[model samples]
Target: MNNQNVFYDELCLSIYTTNRYFHQLYQIVLGKYELTYLQYMVLLNIKQQGKSTLVVICRNLDLDTNTLTPVVKKLMIKNWIKREKSVTDGRSFELFLTNSAEQKFELIQIEIARIQEKLVGDDQQQFTKILSQTHTLNNRVQELIDELTNKK
Candidate 1:
């Protein structure tokens, strides 16, 4: 294979493998709260925004409604979030974190920090480097997605 193709293959494998590993870890940690990673993320967005419409949450998270809707439903069922008709725009639904979710998320945060410290283990520089690269990678992926989407 050519150098570029080899590099691309390695990058894809690394991303896929890392994602799977972290996903497993998240599942184990979040299972206590009956949350999947996506559900937790959606709740995190709502908590951050204080109160926001589904559209706003989706935009902020870069997730489409189709992917988010089911997770939202689960959160609602768990009483971790509530959906109400927007006062300003009745057609849209607003999302808010429940008191319970806020409490749980705080606990989740503490647990996550503990887990991260254990996993990262005094490698602050390496962790910082990974964080920087991951941000750049995500931005590049979004740009590529936009380019391909625009082509269609």
Candidate 2:
């Protein structure tokens, strides 16, 4: 194969392996809190939004209500989050972090900081650039998927 093709193959494998490794590492870090990686992501989404509804979370997380509802319910049961009736929309509820969540967040953040330090290792600028490039790559890959699906 040509050098370009070889690099493409290597790049694909590296992306897959890196994602798998980080996901497993997150699971290990979250295990003590009885949280899965997706659950942790959901929490981050909620925290970022401050007051979010299921529809908004779905949009931000790129998840459907069917997939996210159960996770929200489980978080409620775990006392990590709570839902209050929306003042504007009586039909829907707004989700918020409970005190328990705030408390545990600091503890969870300590390990997350450690992992970030290990990954960054005095290369904050490089890490930020990689994150930006990865986001662009993801959008380009999504466009490719859309085009291929349309052609089918």
Best by lDDT, which number?
2
TM-score versus the correct structure, for each prediction: 0.87, 0.88
Model 2 lDDT tens row, 1-152: 89999999999999999999999988878999999888898888888888889999999888899999999999999999999999999999999899989889778888998998898899999989999999999998988988989942
Per-residue lDDT over 72-131 for candidate 1, one digit per residue giving the tens place of the 0 to 100 score:
988899999998888998898889988888888999988988999999998999999999
* Candidate number of the best TM-score: 2
- Global local distance difference test of model 2: 0.91
Clashes (candidate 1): 0
Full-model lDDT for every candidate = 0.88, 0.91
RMSD of model 1, in Å?
A: 2.0
- After TM-score superposition, the amount by which residue 101's alpha carbon in candidate 1 deviates from its true location, in angstroms, is 2.0
Misplaced by over 4 Å in model 2 are: 1-6
